[model samples]
Target chain A: MSLGEFELIGRYFRSMELGNAGGSEHVTLGIGDDAALISMAPDKQLVVSTDTVVLGTHFPPDYIPANLAYRALAAAVSDLAAMGARPLSFTLALTLPEVDETWLQSFAQGLTDAARDHRISLIGGDTTRGPLNINVTVLGEVRPRNVVRRGDAQPGDLLCVGGPLGDGGGGLAVVLGESMPSSVSDAARDYLFQRFWRPLAQCELGLELAGVASAGLDVSDGLIADARHLAEASGVALHIRLADLPCSAALQAWPEAQRMEWMLGGGDDYVLLFTLPVASIRCLEVWASQGFDVTVIGEAVVGSGIWLDDGQELKEKVQPAGYQHFQRKSND
Target chain B: MSLGEFELIGRYFRSMELGNAGGSEHVTLGIGDDAALISMAPDKQLVVSTDTVVLGTHFPPDYIPANLAYRALAAAVSDLAAMGARPLSFTLALTLPEVDETWLQSFAQGLTDAARDHRISLIGGDTTRGPLNINVTVLGEVRPRNVVRRGDAQPGDLLCVGGPLGDGGGGLAVVLGESMPSSVSDAARDYLFQRFWRPLAQCELGLELAGVASAGLDVSDGLIADARHLAEASGVALHIRLADLPCSAALQAWPEAQRMEWMLGGGDDYVLLFTLPVASIRCLEVWASQGFDVTVIGEAVVGSGIWLDDGQELKEKVQPAGYQHFQRKSND
Candidate 1:
């Protein structure tokens, strides 16, 4: 039951309805072409973002192709979440050295399942032979003027997080075969692994907090780096109480400095780091009543530099911060 | 002499002044963060597209990194051209085994130059260490109702081309070192080589033909495969005269079958294929009046199928068309 390119597309890719996000009635044409064209909501605007995950860099060589498909879409869609936008449509351009039916089936399942869950439709893209890579370009819907941005933080706004950090970052060590403490229980292991392996984009949270939050960004590099972006963009300062930094139970047994290292510098945390008025804490609680939780980590202050609870005046974190490819020097 | 990712991006990618297209005014936030956001045009819709080019698949390995960058951007931009859209922004996700300063500079230069020409800003994207691959996503602007699709070809429309074809296909053979004819004089060699190396995207013609052409698409795969798509989508028959296939003068000395193969099945021909009414042909002469050359290659008839002159059928050309990665069945 092997299929060539056309047949493979016909059998697995085309049959799946990709543009059913209640916007299909508006889509003149969907997939199966050189490109796709669709209209945005009449009252809303369109938001677009793209992310590419390359094998061995974004994931280990032994990473499952199926999960790769899912994670690639997740990482790209997370940008829309950071902007307080609703998932709409995505185009996937996947490259491979060769094709394997089983691998294709699993990969397609991940790609389509995520699309369905997010109410997005497959649009248009290209396929070619090369090293394995998945680039997902996603289009989302946002209110005409309610989208949040990194530059909107105010002096009195409290800095908050959508969930626990360092899970994805710490989980990478496990993937790379680095040994850590045993207090990171098996339940903690599964929790962090799932966080690292299949991160759920906080689209709902983003939209919910759109008007309430002054500034926001997805934590991909690390807490320190992303926190700095928010501060720099808003022309304010961020003061993170080191003791308030959220961590999974996995870090309880590690030395304080090492645990702080993972919490501060471990990249891959896709959680949303944002700032809002202290009054919004009640609104956030109401959001948590709806099943989405948020943690208050610190606050935006009337200052010019980032700070830690230890009173360590952090003038600079690092230049050209975070996970970079063309930086000439590797972050890790 | 040493520059980091931020400095590299500032010196090259951000050099494009997106203010020409009005995207800069709407960029609530630009590059240098989790993602960049652009405000949707008030009256026009947003068009998004993604394309991937592998080292040995789209371009020969010997192709310089800069040209490869320019060529990939050109290929993707051709899609927006088919839709008659205004270029807005692009995201480049580059994957490589290792960061080569020379390669990065050249690739960035090509991308920077192309973007400057079209005023397409480089938005935010990922950079990862892995196999060499580039995935580019482009967003463009179009009137809410003016998009052209393959499904819009009319039964009695005149099938027209934006420009000459087969030049790119023949150019690829030279790049691949598979077929270099001695008869193709040295004077024309550079033209053919450049054509194959950096084929232009028909964005201007596409935007100009929005209301003039009935349907449209770019020739990434061969003409036959794409023509079949146009015929099937429109539910009409396309009748192309085999003797009427266009070619560059350098390729004129090639054998008839070789010429046909290049014209029909040679992928990477980024020319725009479109349909217009015989009555509308006179109107398109406005392009010629504007100093742009247009070619008429075929006509659409009532029925579903694409045929060549001499009464040959498309099925006779082979349905397992174009070059697939698995065509070579490489296990590695």
Candidate 2:
């Protein structure tokens, strides 16, 4: 059955009682009012970020609602994670052509699960009738001194990734009708699909790297384009080794040349790319023990842009074109 | 020239430096980063609200970009005003089919004007290529005890409005090609057009009524529908007098029956409708001297639901329908 705006919000969005995870203290009031009220602790600074995902542009037209919700929320939360912020709460503004009860239920469930995982509440939002679009604004908290920024990367700092990448790109390719490698196992294929559907924002790793990392940001619009951003922001050159690029077993099963394209230029891999001093990396060994696969991939140098390498030979400079919204095509 | 997402944001949105006011104390970081950082004082609670306006649905397809931005921001900020919250910061997510430089300039100017008026900074946001849509998320602050809510109206409380209503409705009629009333003065027509183009949020008045008002909400979806919401939330009946509905001379230029319909059920007024004890309203007399036309219009009763009156005769119950987004039709 189709639901009206009020009933849809009440039946699906409002029932995600996130207060159970000790998060209600942050929310003085939630949905069903003009606005939601929240409180920030004296010692914490609030981090705010917003992201928009439009159907047919951001994903395929027939995408599942649940996965769309999860991916959109994850993408927004990734910005907060880059700032070393812990999730506090989020608001979603959704524009839909029509209300499908089953779709709403699935989307709400995915949003609920994601919010619960990050210990944040869906405090307030608005739903309107239009073409399908989701805009999420996430509020997070970080200690003032521990906030990480992209402009603080130092020359000689080692570049590291919080985890593997390119699985999401591979899955996207498959979803767009590109056949998966026959050699890829069923479990690996499933892993890639899950990675595409539910990208894990590196919040925990970011929090751990708070005061430790020199600079950081989540990989969204391809590694090469994002690396150029970091280099420009930090006033340094980032040199990456293609051999050191991290990938999953599923990605490795793909054609060798195609794997490089996905790993270097593909978008939507929400893993954290950060910089740390060589000595500091050794001191931050606890993350590995905690099951985080922090891998050193490159280093920052005293220069301007981004340079690529294939272990033996220094490759050509990578283009800075990323997944820009208005640009017709950007390496994605 | 058409602009890319980054160029558009950099040229138009980033230059609004709201930190010039006393507000910068709450913002540890502003735009141009992964996330914007904000801090709230220990004594204040944060209030958050979000709203979305899409082309052709919220406004006409050929709406001017500047007025669209202004009205959209005003509508969103009205929610914060309803909660008696002071503006802190805001995030905007805009989706556009194409980037028109002239449109962006006008929209940015309107956004800057509004942000300057409210002294709130544009913290962080996203821009995407899609059908034209604008989503704004506002953050504001209020003292813990002084927070105004919807369910706190007492049986003996007096209902009041911050200012006149229905001018926006009249203006909207003109915008939709309903010929202006033949008797309407040129000045009155201009006033109505201005009201529709730039609805004001009664933030100052709401802040003044912080601890004084028992319950409150901004009149967006007309007085009838919104008052019903208040009554349902407070578990008390609200009796509104038709003759007492504060309206502008511009609205009076329309037909008597049309004016009443617009006053009772028209949307986009963005004025505060609040309830307070009879005695507490007297303490608010100073606001009138300060140029706020605070007028008493109704009272809360012991029972539930809403009742309508025309001074001596009881009028038919006003239908509790307004400009609901997903509903097929309302007054708008």
Q: Which CAPRI level is candidate 2? A: medium
Candidate 2 at A243: error in angstroms?
Answer: 1.5
TM-score of each: 0.88, 0.93
Candidate 2 regions with alpha-carbon error over 4 angstroms: A1-4, A19-22, A310-332, B1-5, B18-22, B310-332
Find the 10 residues in a row with the least total lDDT in model 1 chain A: A323-332
- The residue pairs that clash in candidate 1, if any, are A18-A121
The residue-by-residue lDDT of candidate 2 on A1-332, one tens digit each, is: 12345565666887885532536678889998899998889888889999988865336667788888888888888888899999888998988877778888889988877776677788888887778888999999999999999999999999988878777678787666567668988787778778888888999898988988989888887676677668878998898987899988778888877777778767678888889977786645788789888888899998876777733322233233332221322211
Q: Clash number for every model?
A: 1, 0
Highest-DockQ candidate: 2
RMSD per model, one decimal: 4.1, 3.3
Lowest lDDT 10-mer window, candidate 1 chain B? B323-332
* lDDT agreement with native, every candidate: 0.73, 0.79
